[model samples]
Target: MSDRLFEHSSQGVSRGLSAGSPGSGRRLVVEADGGSRGNPGRAAYGAVVRDAESGDVLARAAERIGTATNNVAEYNGLIAGLRLARELDAAAHVEIRMDSKLVIEQMAGRWKVKHADMRRLAEQARALVPANPTWTWVPRERNKTADALLNAVLDGGPPVWEVGASASTPVAADPTGRPAEETAPAEASAPARGWGAEVGGATTLLLLRHGETERSQAKRFSGSGGEDVSLTERGRAQAAAAARSLADRLGVAAVVSSPLRRTRQTAEVVAATLGLPVEVEPGLAETAFGEWDGFTFAEVGQRWPAELQAWLADTSVAPPGGESFEQVLIRVRAARDRLIRTYGGKTVVVVTHVTPIKLLTCLALDVPARAAYRMELPPAALTEVAWFADGAASLRSFGVPAEVPEDGEPIHG
Candidate 1:
């Protein structure tokens, strides 16, 4: 065994240790971090342990795992750090830190992990320590070593130990380690959004598209210009019918709507049944179809075949004076952030357009914007998003129940 691992190594033998010395009742400090390039892409986790007294690191670990999420990576990190601490059988306690809020929350019992992948990962992480330890959720800024280890795995670097201060068998890091870097400044405060606001309570948003409009029936492109378009008689009946069907099921706390007349009219019907006023969210407006506004599908496909093709293939393509799907995504993301930030953890009914609804679906699916064009939204439709506090969002339901018919008809919306 290394002399430094003994109870009476000279201070010179463990000069770098800062937290504690090599004696009984000493505590351990652990830092763990995880990363995935494409998120659900290639993933890795890393962790390191330093002697409390001499401040010298004792052991280093990193693992390249199969495909996993950022949360999965984080759990693996916790697992790695826990295992490292376990190897030091005499250590009475450990102070742990990580960058993932979900891991911190789930481990802290403040959030529920419903995904099978995360559930398994969480079980493994719990297997590390005895289900409890001193832990904190630090931002990416404070976690340098573990973050570096994760990056090393992602950057095509050699195996985990190729760079860290790990070479000889259980050796001391140095007589005096390079002075610790200045501690990162504290991050500006940000209130929790979505699910993490409360312990075990998830904030859910019920997203519903507006009822049919004249443009919807005509199959014309309706953008910002159709702000004043009124719903047809059929549309009005559809909204009222949907309201009656949804009222008993969705105990909506608030009714939020787009500023457009069609959307406002749709909101009125839903609000009437739910007994809530419509709060206008201007950011959730539909795509500005520009010169393509009021043009039927056949007209656009005929007159602007090349432009239309480009728009379909590439989300950035704009038809004459209209907005691209990318623009719509940016705004809808802002709208989602705002709503989740403002009414977090509460069920809010968002009555809006097809494009915005599809955007929410896309965000939940985490797919590219081009994929939105492939989404089909029936009028007066219902979709549900369970927004988690960890900045993670989930799609629980899409397009309402198939049994939900349009108006009196048995055809589903």
Candidate 2:
């Protein structure tokens, strides 16, 4: 529904989710709700940003999350609200209220993700904020907007809503109530950016990074010629966790990988999960590290501190025997262009290494070169970015999802 419908006096003030002071609330208040019909069945999430006191929506987000459980859907809703509020204003202190108790406790560090998928997703949510985006648990009654949005998502929408359904105290479901909301998949709230590809013509690349490698495991510098060491035991576990999670969420799609074992093995994990083939893309390989290929961080610092510092300080600088960040970016960019030209709008999984994923994220976010260096990816973690026909891109998620728990320490990652 066009949220603009809430902008007029013509429609006598319907009881908005706010009571006496939503608009005037001191902090930005985020109310998020999500639901799945069969736990892991069809689901959707909705979130609304209220000014706090006077209960006016500064922004609203709602969408179908495909088939996920209520908990996953709820986390998606919370993360969406957190991210929207951040994009709208970074410094704005937000008081996020959710109807999911699991999210509240997990986000509060009271729960450990016994489930691998949930653990990773939990991490993704943590990365959404600059730091402490203040999450709270509210009674179902208080989260009316998010609830309504979720219900709308559940019913498919043929849109249970119209442009102006008289924004009264939003039609909340009676937890036990049946909604009269329309039923069809709600059209996505016109993406922030456009991807003008033919219907189903846009090639969607699911940019994935390999799980931990021996280099990553040993905190050693790893690059293109590191002999393509395979994923360490934990790396294998991370990749498997990711594969199972992706299989549940995105079902399956094409799988492509760097021939390097770290990535090739990662691809195999996902391929096994999705019953897809692993297409090797040599162009997707990690950088050729030349001389310092498998050196430890301490070794690199002791021997090549000057060179390392210069490269870190400037992406244009190359390692003693490795390619410059810019060079990697160029090759990855070419590979990406080629993929898009080939696949268009279809969602395909691309399992590769860190530099390429972060570089692609930087491109999508339109940030500077130094910014790519600032990204922090996890072992067997996942991030998503989308590119459009007009050359615009958006970072759907960077690093990993909060499906897994973190150290409760706030991160700038």
Query: In lDDT terms, which candidate is top?
Result: 1
lDDT of 1 by residue, 234-351 (tens): 7777777677767776556888998898889989988988888889999888888988899998899999998888777655456687776755765676577667757867888898
> Number of clashing residue pairs in every model?
14, 49
lDDT of 2 at 110: 65
- In terms of TM-score, the best-performing candidate is 1
C-alpha lDDT values of all predictions: 0.67, 0.65
**lDDT string, candidate 2, 311-369, tens digits:** 67655456776776655764676577667656666678899888888877765654544
TM-score of each: 0.53, 0.49
Residues forming the 10-long window of minimal summed lDDT in candidate 2: 158-167
What TM-score would candidate 1 get against the native?
A: 0.53
Local distance difference test, candidate 2: 0.65
